[model samples]
Target: MKNTRIKNIIFDLGDVILNIDVPVASQSFAELSGREQSEILAIFNENEIFRQFETGSMDEAGFRNFIREILEFDDLSDEAIDTAWNSLLLDLPPERVELLKNLGTQYRLFLLSNTSSIHITQVNKILEASTGVKKLQDLFETVFLSYEMGVMKPDPLIYQKVLAQAGIKADETLFLDDNYDNIQAAAKLGIEVIHVQKPTTILEYLKDYAV
Candidate 1:
């Protein structure tokens, strides 16, 4: 039932490739906001400021300002904000990077991530520091950031855009994401999906895929 003709692969960034600890970020925000982590996370869950930043409606400076206004942390320095915002980002293991680099030669690789500028800055630092690989973009045919695309995952537009831009049929492409909602969205559009989970790494899961 698998599509052997699949020529393109779309990958998600956080949790799938890079580790993210949301609790660490929540704790950082709670300390800054003088609120419980639960309250801060609740606000984050419903916050338009976050959506706007991720969708490129706001830049890093604007996002910092919005955080100050929303969290009532008027004294929060830009450095502090960037640090706390990037708290959730963890290491990008060298193995993952090697796998991606190898896969690039065998398939058309693409990266799709819902992220902000501050986080991306840290992500790049981690990648370079961990593997001396300065950029993942070099391995990808094209990298699609939600911020750059002005649309986040689970949205039809982002999926449609990638498919159209790559000139690939949805059924002939595979998408890998950590979030079920994101996978579901792409699946609805006819893309094959692998729900990348914690116990299984991307490389392990794809060992038999398209082989």
Candidate 2:
């Protein structure tokens, strides 16, 4: 039977369920770029490259090429680029994985993420290398990626797409994401939201939903 009150739950990947070390990535990029971390950080917000990659407009190789072009540093290899780009993904706590499995037995659980092919590949490799983490897709009934879908969060279409795919309604769905803009976007569309913030986690925020 479908859960009438909260029939479905959609989760974001980075920082919400998965741990990301932005500082580590920043430092890595700084070293590679020969610039300050602050400068590298600024590029993330101002550069449309992120959107390009996340929306499938750019491939992993193209991204590396763009990085070299923008940085004007052509000597970095593909391995170097993947390492620096993936530095932000730290670890996925076992508790979160366990929680997702538990939640799946009750509400319909879904994973909606803004990610690219290179990053997802690296995330799985990191997890497998460190703790032998299970495949992320296996834990959820559906995995909606921005790169695969060609749409990202904070855009109303993504949320609509998830609902459409799941055959669910916004009011009966709960969405959790680390980014405030994403939370706002879902909430504005009448989806329940938990802004998964620092010092708290998906396990804690969704404590009420855990069976």
Candidate 3:
């Protein structure tokens, strides 16, 4: 079942292996800030601060301060803000864990995600609670995070960095992501890519190789 050409596999985190609902987090923030959910969603999608936070240009404290300033709620505690921000992260299904474990045996697995520290903390907690995994690093050879690398997906540099760091050839690696842009970017770099579209998950896409 193994693909001889692909010696390495790079996975995207949100909506691929882990479930995420942006609207859910927006609704939670809406409740806390007394703003419409749409407004919160719009800000998340359009705001530069969110991207900056993910790329490590803004620290957690700075992000929280910006949240207070924008939401006009200086009294909001850090815990409350974090809860609202992390509410989007739903769960990591057991099936996905099994799939990754099985794939790890036949391929060098890696995780490359555009994410922030706060979300990753919640992701680890969720992973441990659901799959008994203490950390995501246990499931992959190397975990490349945007915050740590100061670069994100769809940027050629990030993909190049991953290939260099892992010592994997582009044509010999397969990249799976829910984002079309990310998939195309990887493809343009000569890496095999699968656009893990909605209604079709990574588990289903790689069913042939799973277990």
Q: Which candidate leads the pack in TM-score?
A: 3
After superposition on all CA atoms, how large is the RMSD of candidate 3? 1.5
| Residue 181 C-alpha lDDT in model 1 | 97
**Model 3 TM-score (2 dp):** 0.95
lDDT score of residue 54 within candidate 2? 94
lDDT of 2: 0.86
- Listed in order, each prediction's TM-score against the native is 0.94, 0.92, 0.95
Q: Considering every candidate listed, which one attains the maximal lDDT?
A: 3
Give the runs in model 2 whose Cα sits over 4 Å from its true position: 1-4, 43-46, 129-133
Distance (Å) between predicted and true CA of 134, model 1?
0.5
Which lDDT tens digits does candidate 1 get at residues 108-205?
A: 89999999878888898899999998876766889899999999989989999999998888988999999999999999999999999887998787
lDDT of 1 at 171: 84
Worst 10 residues of 1 by lDDT: 202-211
